[model samples]
Target: CHYCTFVTVPGKLRRAGHGMFLSPDEVLAIAREGAAMGCKEALFTLGDRPEDRWPEAREWLEAEGYDDTLAYVRAMAIRVLEETGLLPHLNPGVMTWTDLQRLKPVAPSMGMMLETTATRLWSEPGGPHHGSPDKEPAVRLRVLEDAGRSNVPFTTGILIGIGESYEERADSLFELRKTARAYHGIQEVIVQNFRAKPDTAMRGMPDAELEELAAAIAVARHILGPSARI
Candidate 1:
């Protein structure tokens, strides 16, 4: 996305710097280390389907005998649960019902950031999420609903001050409340503040003030009621 701040290593940056995927053994070793340190959750945060965009990613997946990045994630999650003291918490983006079903048993909980429900963000080429299909409000919302339908505990929330209005923020919270009421599968709502980062498209933008986040939290609590955690 245009507002993203993830660091990228170009193909020529280092020797054979196309990219690399961690092995299942490597994953298990890290999980073991975390377990030894008394960490309760192994949070797996990854880009969705890098194989679709990079030839090197595709080649690596094929050579590794995995169909896709998500498949590898599931495998690693299973390994972590079976071999370590940590519960695997996945943040793989935009999962379908089948994806949720396949991951539920191995992954106790997973997350996808609702970000914002404002359709306007996807309408302009310069918008933060204009090029990110998974960031679309409808697609993200469907993942939340599917997680509910599939009985997978989910974590979702909005990123304040990303060009969305207060009305849109309220709308997004209402949508989350609707999903939580329908299936009782949502476990957490993160009221995150967006900070400007250098080299990002939104670097020049102002950081989200604490007051805005407080407003959102208050609205979230009011909409989701006392039972929901803000």
Candidate 2:
């Protein structure tokens, strides 16, 4: 439904609501609605920022007294899922070792896909999220190493087309592969196409073509080796 909401024709059915940002009761209600439709596994993606793409939406929630931090979001997710007996049906993204430890027991083996948006998007010298790749790599390695200590399986992916070059894409894959080699936990790679959403700096920019995405995936598979999945 989330997919259809965005990609549908004429934008006839938009996913506009405060429910997506706040209101645990509303979120739980939607989860129940999904379950009733035979969705055995409910997958809810909690965005890293409330308004990283839609600042107005995020601000609205803040005005209404919503906690926008990842920690609060995770706690709310766990709360609603448990309250409605949907805990077994939930899967949340863990960004760091601390988050992994916190959510693993609640949603064991849940995906902890390492986020790399800043790595690529911020590569430009003046990019808003800019940080050195040199520093980025160590953070990634620590995430992988900590995932190993937890004795749990996981999956990871990358956000592409953030004004990064093809070489940078390949380099990102190489770094991910290096981490996977040491941890042996990362099992899948999702190469996400960046969307130029409203209220974001990248709005109106073209999204990546299918061929570019395929090529990147192919290169990623090669870099990750035959044993590792991409």
Candidate 3:
């Protein structure tokens, strides 16, 4: 997303494709160490589908005998579970029913940030989500429903700031509540505030104030209720 400041290798570095992923053995070794350090859950928060964006990602996957990043993640999740005895919580972005089903056996939970349901941010030019296809509200809501249908414990939430109005924030929480009420698979909802970074596309955007976060959290509580973990 345009507002994101997460460390990622895009464009030139992605095209260069010089780096390689650690082998499964190496990943398991780290997980095992984490388990020794009393970490019971191995959280995997990955960038969405880099292979779809860069051919280098595809080439790297092919070199490793995987067709896509999701399959690689599933395989790694299985390895983490079997070798390290750490429960895996995946956040591989928007996923389909089949993808959820495939990852469910190894992953106890998964998450994807809903951000907001405002189509304006996604459809209008110069908006935070305009060029980001995975940030599409319909697609994200579909993922939520699919996770519910699959009986997977899921985490999701609305992001405050980023130019969405209070109404859009409320609507996003309500959408989450609707899915939670239907399938009871939602484990938690996070109310996150945007913290723009100097290096990001949203560097000039104002940071979300405490008032906005408090308001959003209050509304989330009202919509999702006291029983809901927010």
Candidate 4:
């Protein structure tokens, strides 16, 4: 549930050591939240959004003078990856296989995944992803399969509670599993219940019920247990 949000640079802007200075308190907060939820592993990621202005976000980063900090984080991430040691989950959102291949020399063992679970934007009549749902899955699978071919062992997750249905969740898992098999190595599956964070578009929207979460996990476990690690 602590996945990073990369709505700013294309792929490499707010990763580990970038201007993003996470405090000990922040790390502890993440660890506590993850442990409280019975999670065996904690997650972390870099933020990248190539399409937006990010006036406020940029100002904050500039104030922090992240040049040196980012360099250090990059080195640390590389160490973790190269050693194949799990340091939470490393998320590089909406990235291509070519880009991921470049990442392999750094953190081979750390978990990597595509951030395909963001909420849909319906406000803009003709937005970037207006009709993206149909084609995005295939594009995502192509990349996942590539990760498999390299033996990088990765996983896929989703954004639930954003008006997605029981059937949709089941279908998404089924499709991800199918895609993962084609790729070769999948470690685990994660499901995040949608929470309407304050100031977000769907802030006032209701989240999914407990029954929905339980049902989804049960279904996924049943469906993915035989072959891949779920």
Candidate 5:
């Protein structure tokens, strides 16, 4: 059975009071429940260092007895392992080598979506990753490199239909393949199609067509080969 739980935290892209801010105990309790209900994995998805961008996030972390979001996540991950025995898969956005090392012990795996390697998205006004510093392709690639150096099994992939050209999508897949070959630590590549939400910045963007998604998957399979899971 595959069951999962998400631990939400403030993100750089989110406005103040955007989501629930959970305490360590609260997070642990959720993990325990998930375990009791037969969950095998817990995904800790947090904003990439919300404290750096939002004063409210920083104050909340400090008041909660954590120096930073990663510290809080580390403690919660340890608790999830020790108390519930679920393998934690962290998707806490961009991370450094030191951050990966710190949480690697408790987490069996971690992930971040490369989204796309196109720099134009960053420069484009109202682009998907516009204003989201942590969403930079170079920074995300560096995180993948760091994860490889740390020998951590990682999950990464591309987000299609986010204002990227077909060529850009291919480029993204190729970059992932190169990184995976170099590190041999990439466990899976998730080929996710973007779904625009009603309240988000990309609300008006059309979803990728079925044929486009199929083509993207075919490209990923060809580049990453049989060993890669897409």
Candidate 6:
């Protein structure tokens, strides 16, 4: 069984409605409901360090009595584990060594999409990750390394149809495999195809064809070897 959780706050908190943010009590209640429904894992999906991006985000965290988003998440994870019996899996995006160390004990596992290893897209006008500071490929790789150093079970993968060449997709998978082999922390690799959404930067972009997706998955399997889970 699977369940999910989101901080619900956008990077710019002012851009979101008041109802978007969920209180700690609300999170616990949802966890209890998930436990009753036989859900065994909870995924914490939220903005990556929104407090650093917007003043309103910082204000909200302060108002909630949390010094930072990671602290708040750690507390929620512990609460969910103690009260609801669901293992917490976090997707907090790019993190530092300290962040990984702090989260490792509370979250049994964690993840972040490698998306792509291509840095060229970041410079393209109106590219999917153009303005996102945390989307830097090198930064994301560092997070993976730090997670490995912390001995955390990790999940990571490449994103297709994001203006990356087939070669770049293979590069991303190879990079992930190298890190996984070195650290032994990567437990799963996901091959995700990008779907353009409305009112976003890549809305007009085309989705990956089935053939392309299959090829990418094959590359992942080949690079990650038989011992890896895909």
Expressed as tens digits, the lDDT of each residue in 30-109 for candidate 2 is 77886677665445565444354465656656776754555455666576566655544223432566767766665544
- Model 4, 1-230: lDDT tens digits are 22123233423445544533454355556566656676655455654321224554445545655333333334555443333333445564445566566656654333433334223432233422344342255565566677778777686665566554566567777767776667667776777676656644445667777887787777877877775555
**On a 0 to 100 scale, what is the lDDT of residue 206 in model 2?**
81
lDDT tens digits by residue: candidate 6, 1-230 = 00012333453344554433568888999889888999999888787877886677787789889999899999999999998899999987888899988888999999998888888766566666776677888988989998998899999888888888888888899899889989999999999887766655556678788898898888888888988898
Clashing residue pairs, backbone N/CA/C < 3 A, model 2: none
**TM-score for candidate 4, residues paired by index:** 0.61
Q: Compose the digit string of candidate 5's lDDT tens values, residues 1-230.
A: 00012323346225554533676777888888999899999989876787887787888888878999999888888888888899999999889889998999989999998989998787677676777677778999999999998999999999888889999999999999989999899999999887766545567778888888999999899988988899
lDDT of candidate 2 vs native? 0.58
Q: Number of clashing pairs, model 4? A: 14
In order, candidate lDDTs are 0.86, 0.58, 0.88, 0.53, 0.84, 0.82
Off by over 4 Å in 4: 1-44, 49-74, 79-89, 110-135, 226-228
Per-residue lDDT over 54-166 for candidate 1, one digit per residue giving the tens place of the 0 to 100 score: 78778888998898888889888888888896899999788888888888888889999898899988878888889888788999999999999988888888889988999
Q: Is candidate 1 or candidate 6 better by lDDT?
A: 1
Rank candidates, lDDT, best first.
3, 1, 5, 6, 2, 4
Q: Quick one: ranking by TM-score, best first? A: 1, 3, 6, 5, 2, 4
Any idea what lDDT model 4 has?
0.53
- Candidate 4: residue 35 Cα off by (Å): 16
List candidate 3 segments past 4 Å from native: 10-22
TM-score of each: 0.93, 0.65, 0.93, 0.61, 0.89, 0.91
Q: Going through the candidates in order, what is the number of backbone clashes in each?
A: 0, 0, 0, 14, 0, 0
How big is the positional error of residue 225 in model 2, measured in Å on the Cα after superposition? 3.8
Residue pairs in steric clash, candidate 1? none
Q: What local lDDT score does residue 109 receive in model 6, on the 0 to 100 scale?
A: 100
TM-score of structure candidate 1: 0.93
Selected candidate, larger lDDT, 2 vs 4? 2
Q: Report per-prediction Cα RMSD to one decimal.
A: 1.8, 6.7, 2.1, 7.3, 4.8, 4.1
